[model samples]
Target: MIDYNYVLRNHILTHNQIGNASDKSNTQRCDVCGTFLSSAYALKAHLQLHSDNSKPYTCTLCDRRYSSVHSLRMHEQLHTGEKPFKCEICGKDFSLRATYKTHMFLHSGERPHKCVLCGKRFKLSSSLKMHIRTHTGEKPHNCDTCGKGFSTLGNLRRHQRIHTGEKPYKCTECGREFNQSNSLKAHMHIHTGENLPKYDISVIIYSLS
Candidate 1:
């Protein structure tokens, strides 16, 4: 029989020795896969992939998150939510630049994605893939909080907030609640003196009663 207490003590001592060896060796590891991260910043970002606690880069339209600020800017259309990218044929609106590019094919009558099962065509490959998933009944995007299903990961992310009650956007002036930061920014104009646009007009009328 082995002395379990002695073995545990020895293991702890060895782990402490290794930890104190150098700062370069004490990198953060992935909790799930044990992948070593190079820097603390990278480790912090990698941790966000696991939990819904952090969202540094927020979308202006719907308060979505991305690893980079540029991605948030790209996601802003869901709010100005302006869908400037219009389909030439039916005038359908799309927030994504690529989706708009794909919609342009409607005017050209181009079918890029061909279905082998039913001889069908699609303008975008992603749409065709989603359509195929319907035949297979594939629902990969699921909400961890409420056990709801979504077709896209983005939709699932948006739904998860209902359970977490995580409203990251807040008005700086009045502390009002908003789903998106852009809305908070717009609300801030109420405090700033820029709420109304300037217009000048002069009118003179003479009437006899």
Candidate 2:
């Protein structure tokens, strides 16, 4: 006959040892999720679920993708009517971080994207892509209305707006109209007077130009 109490005590000690070992390891393989990741990254990603503070990457064209929840938050600026990034040339305001980064080249006169045909330099790759469409005569953005076509989806969407008059972006506070949701969200800040938390400050500064 085995000593059940002694076996239980040993099992408890073994569990504690395993727990301590897991705490010390920088990376671990999760048995439940079958994910192998660094403890810090895993913890940060895990914590994103508890609160609304986690996106770090955002797509300016659409509110469809987020690199991190922290990134999605900064993207809310587009809807809030906040233009932290300003352009010296036209005094234009940009809502997206990546757009601001692209705009910096205009002031610096740094044309990294060059045209092979005419050697024309552009500050942004997307601009270069659009310019190339002109040379290629390739209109990717097709309008369902009147079977029209455009080089950029933005142009096509704008054209479509003329027909539908549909503005999906709405401000929670004032019910303002916008093409993008980020703009509306940013507008709500005026009513709420909310500020970013300390932990998110670094992420905001890093993402914003």
Candidate 3:
């Protein structure tokens, strides 16, 4: 059902154009996939992905696959609970280097991705894409029970809980049930008497009389 060709037409055309423009005499062919590359360097780099020597390193825990040993070592951190990549600004630890780099943008106030319609900038491409949906009024995530639409999958999932009557969160003191976790925390504060100031009901009645 997915039209991958139409979706990746631009990417395919770029590679095909490069292959076509290269000299046929000097072109190198990939033995595995039969893809004609412009130079030996490109061909060699491509072959590294498919070579038998590639992906020699394997994860012992989950049996997840990786192309290189360095990749496998990085994957192992998920199981070992190691966070090597740390943000200098907030001191947040990330499991991967790419995640750490992305978090740094938040502190630097660098919004690279911009919206064409609203001229709003976002630090990440995903944030910009979500902002575009707001302008388009697009609600792709739908509730199965009520047929309600939401902008995000998380909002849709939360909406479904209303139909299911699933109250997962409960108060420890009074055993009061709440649909949301934040509501439960607020309810707990009522018992703790932390937020609200105590008021005399008799004082208002006496004043009125």
| Candidate 3 per-residue C-alpha lDDT over 1-209 given as tens digits, one digit per residue, 9 for 90 to 100 | 98764555433333432333244753788889676676788789888878656776778998777877889988898899899988877788998886777898878889887766557898888787677667655566668787787877877877788888888888788776766665665566567877633335443232223
- Encode model 1's per-residue lDDT on 60-143: one tens digit a residue: 556667776667776776666677677767878888898788768867889988755455789889877666555444455767
Off by over 4 Å in 2: 1-63, 77-96, 153-209
> Considering summed lDDT, which 10 consecutive residues are worst modelled in model 2?
12-21
Q: Which is the leading candidate under TM-score?
A: 3
Order of quality (lDDT): 3, 2, 1
Which of the two candidates, 1 or 3, achieves a greater lDDT against the reference?
3
Candidate 3: list runs displaced more than 4 Å: 1-76, 80-82, 171-173, 181-209
Residue 171 in model 2: shift from native, Å? 32
Q: Estimate each model's TM-score.
A: 0.33, 0.34, 0.49
Clashes per model (N, Cα, C within 3 A): 0, 18, 0
Q: Alpha carbon lDDT of residue 183, candidate 1?
A: 46
The superposed Cα distance between candidate 1 and the true structure at residue 177, in angstroms, equals: 39
